[model samples]
Target: MLLRKPAASELSAEPILSAAENYSGEMHAIDTGVRVDAVEFARGRVALGRLLAKRGIGYGDRVVMAVANGPLFAAALCAVLARGASPLILHAKTPAAEMRRYAERYAARMVFGDGSSETEYRETGLEPYLVEAADWARLLCANVKIVDESAGNVSLVLPGVPLHPTSGTTGQPKVALRPGRPAIAEAAHYIETTGIQASDTILVAAPQSHAYCYGMGTMVPLLCGASIITMRGFEAGLVQSALRDTNVTVVPAVPAMLGSLMFGTRGDLFARVNTVFSAGAPLNEKTAKAFANKFGIAVRPLYGTTETGGIAISLPGSQAVAGICVGPAMKDVEVDVRDDGQGLAPGLGMTYVRSESMMTGYLDENGLDQSFVVDGWFKTGDIANQDTEGRIYLHGRQSEVINVAGMKVIPSEVENVLLRISGVIEAKVYSREHRTGSQSVQAAVVAHGVDDADVRAHCEKNLVYYKRPSMISFVEALPRNATGKIDMAALSNL
Candidate 1:
């Protein structure tokens, strides 16, 4: 059966009540051993909204939410949205200094978290509303008055509000502000592209604070009336158990985490999942092929950023396309491949997206304005090539591209080549400043029983002379950030 396209009107409607009415009888979430119904979730959100309003939280207020993915987190997001406030969903595991910095950067007026987080925030000299899991039910149920179900004035503030942080592999994370409608549209597009349905169950192992989880993991399922089973963190064992125990049909994961699941001790446990969405970083061909061979399910590669909601381009399982192609631009989203340096079109340059999911902008005391775009399109900063058939293939971040003697090389190309090596477990390639004056190609590899000579020989077969790594360092493991992406800054220091 063909999945119907989501109505634009529904996309513009309030996300809080949309899932409630659509999936009223369906189970909405499974956190640990607790199962929450859609109706109960909606009521909780309403009550929480009222409670927050009473605490002086109002429309356009920035609420820094440092929490994990669970019933309380979902309720908090809904409550904030209901109260016409925007949620800056911070990673619960983020260092306190970074969290405090973000709160200060965004000029956040209110903060919400558990007792421990609240204590940490207080230590940082910010007095925030502290709500624990035990009291969340009571707090949300305290004020049960009917409030405006309309998306409220907070949605209007979205066009200029920086609400979330963009993960930076090479530098400090930046805040990306997305208007409410764009977020809703992105969620709607995700549902349409993936054919999400009320009967489908989504397993969210990714961090909800990130765009991938915010859209595919949380928003998409809720908007489409599908249930969500959220795991607080990514664990191969926990993921396997969820897949086998729950009716989890859809999963969104980063390539590294997916690689661990496919090649780790729990490799064979993902056979029950019907569809898998891989994103956050470049998805290599080996992992893609291995996942399909092992699970009889296609690993759908998606491309997008915090600046552009969940998926800008994606391929469905029904599609025969495979490997690192991100399929096509989603409906209501436009992708352009521009010329390098010039930023003009028809060459392998930077990718630009014009979509409903475009962020408002990065925030500052001067307020949000033109920081991410030239005209109407958001500069993706990702280097990609669009084929004649309109399929997008991401190479690597334009900023991370290695320039060896004026020759440009994408790290993903080198990384893919190294992964093909016999004993290589994982590989990352970057550019390092040489004492001789120019930047040289460097590679850090994680392998078992493989030496630098073996990796160089492997690279020799795949990469050109200038593209090969001049310096190769073998590490036990690559340093990754909270979101499981390679920490290039840390690598540079090494």
Candidate 2:
């Protein structure tokens, strides 16, 4: 009942599909050198949907797509959903074997992959349909792809939703099922809150597979009749060039990507860009301030999880509260904190959120995992505090909290102290377990001129005995996943 049926003359025209047909601007895939206007995008999706339906991807069928951020991803998503099939997205760089493993594990009916991964899919008996940006020009314009015009124009019936895999910062990734109407509602909320206009152009450097980028980077822009240019992956040089060449008005990125772009730049590059959204990971004070100082625009913090499409975002021109605020709850979203007695600040506690856009439940081996929800609220497993004006200040995830003999050490608090030390570029604080079954605080730092002793001296002066790092290792860089969150598993091995 949420999505009204489109007219018989229209092709799969729902909210996002309808917007694609009505809007006129182009969506570009920089790596593939492909660009198409809204009408072309809509037609391409319809054609692709028919192809998928013919391939036996219909109601209740789940298809796994290992496509990157580009026109192919956007068009393919609409196509799969329009066919009443669930689509599971994986990172483009995900290996062929891993892609096949996920497909088999998730019981996917088929797979859709790029040219590079097609052979692996076929070898694994996945029978993947190869989707290429190079083929898009022909696919979008060629009427031959759609055998029956009337069948293509028939109403798009939805019987399945999209599936998203959690970032798995703490452990193995979990599959999340998000209902169709709620996901669309979340996209509409984001468009209204961000004030996205029909003329605005968004540069989506983040991978489209992630829920945050899928909404802000793709769906919100399309639904608002705005243009979007997508990159296969995050690259500082290509992003800078895109900014210089394209009329980009908005940029949606993670904290690490924003931090990387702060160097070797003049204020003029982002002169036309009005909004820069930082999510996926914590937005440090240094990165936010340096970006604002260089470009005259502050990086707005957007807080969300794979389980929830988007929760809160800092409003335009809002000041950061101690350089750690995610402004306020999104429209129709409820956010609150609960005391877990884990030794946080006075008001800080475990963060909980409930929203219309929240996933139905986590997909597990047995079936769905609704145990994560209490009443109607989803426990976010984040340590945070909310002010009277309703802004949320995040410390870090509860799982990331390092407990030193009953004393809790928040990683962000220690990382912030390290950043204050001169020459320290990046820092990650984690717990190291000893042979005696006790956890000790360990810090890994990336710095230009600072050494272990200097870091030790600074921490001794600023932090309590238990909160200070027992071991410090200097590294050239921190290992981060595709979404820019520190790969804790990789860090532990280091």
Candidate 3:
């Protein structure tokens, strides 16, 4: 009698780890490289896995991770997968209050990060692990006893949590929990569609917690057996050095990072780069062309969201023609641009996509809100149009998603914090478009005692730097429309 071996569930990281083991490439960081072959990857996985196991982080337990984007963070991610546990990865500099709230919300078994972050987590009265990314890299290098593997050679489990968070009108963060683990197929599609090579070295220049960075930095490279060069944050000096020193094949960068490279540094930055993908926000076509002219590699626009996965990528070797062309829908993905038949041919309207990687829906106090997803199509709240050539041209977003150098900031989220300050009766935030084609956060506040400086200081303590209001107008009262609703246009004009 012939029998089939047990298979991992749909959402586990095992598939990628297993495939990664077949390739001999190491995961390189600013410090050094760690071999990713099956045996070596297993060693690191087991060492960390044993540590987590000792801490009572076993199968199905949830762990919260607040670490910088680097080798140690990557190793912790591997450890989470090895122990069959769910992880909620946050920015290394996430505020202590925010980190504690997330840990409580997710019911995390333990928290992990560097010593400094651990101190923050400790203030929450929760169990936290203080581990360094460099130390994990070293541990992966040392000879260690292999812990017994999980029950299956490939075990997939969906975390159903957030490494990225979006917000609602109420200013509360909402996480989309996709049901199944189709990550293997999703990652494969990304690898194949992006033309990833086994010999390639990928550079992740964004925060590892961001969706784009996590997918490009962690998933795609791991599955393809490609070396990954990561940074804790967007450091221009570190990025320039990595590109100059390493034959960096692909760079997944936001527009701001590329902008710095354009004006601050030049020459041979693109000598070895196979592809450079600009996502999170739009890139200036003029600067893009100038860089392409100098480097021989065109800056390609990429479009995706925390909910939509990666929707489109600029076709390799293709230059922008007219509007912002985010190439075409990736493999195994279908995009249907709906305009209510407004007679706008290839009209600008809401974008919808059906893909294996689309998130199930938003999760919050309201439970899962799949209203955004009708049938199998997920509504990507961005306004876009597609030409006959199947290229996607993005216009703007449905909501005020301030793109401060590719860091997404929801206006209501900042406004909520603004309202919390003493004497702040009303608050409205908006995005101001810059000459460089990117956007910055700005706000108009109606308060009694707070000055512009006070408002800025409040935001500094409450929100991330990108989310803080760069320009603030302390108005006596905000203008309202006929319906008694705050006129966003008038606020923007202010």
Q: What are the RMSD figures for all models against the true structure?
A: 6.8, 6.4, 12.3
Model 3, global lDDT: 0.65
Better lDDT candidate (2, 3)? 2
Candidate 1, residues 1-494, lDDT tens digits: the string is 11222233322326444553465424333445666777677766677777778777776566677677766666777777666666777886764545556555555556665424545555666554433333334321111111322322222344113277765333456666665567767888887776877788888888887878887776676677778887667888777778767778888888878787875545455656667888877676766777777777778888778877754556556234344578888887888888757432246777788887776556544444454565668777777788887888777787887777777777877887888887787788999987886889888988898998888888788888988999999898888877877888899987
Candidate closer to the true structure by TM-score (higher is better), 2 or 3: 2
Query: Which candidate gets the maximum lDDT versus the true structure?
Result: 2
Model 2 weakest 10-residue run by lDDT: 137-146
Of the pair 1 and 2, which is ahead by TM-score? 2
- Residues 1-494, candidate 3: write the lDDT tens digits: 11221134434566655654564566655643433444555566557767667656677665666666655666677677667776677767666656656655645556665424444545655444333222444321111111322422112233423334654323446765432244455566688788897789888768777777777776776677777777666677878888888878889877657656775666777788888888766554554766788778888887777676777888987775412678888898899888854333246767888887876556444233557666778776666778898889875555656667756675655766777787876666788987889898888877787798888788889987888888999887667532123566787677
The TM-score measured for candidate 1 stands at 0.85
The lDDT of each candidate is 0.68, 0.75, 0.65
Model 3 is weakest, by summed lDDT over 10 consecutive residues, at 139-148
Q: TM-score, each model?
A: 0.85, 0.89, 0.71
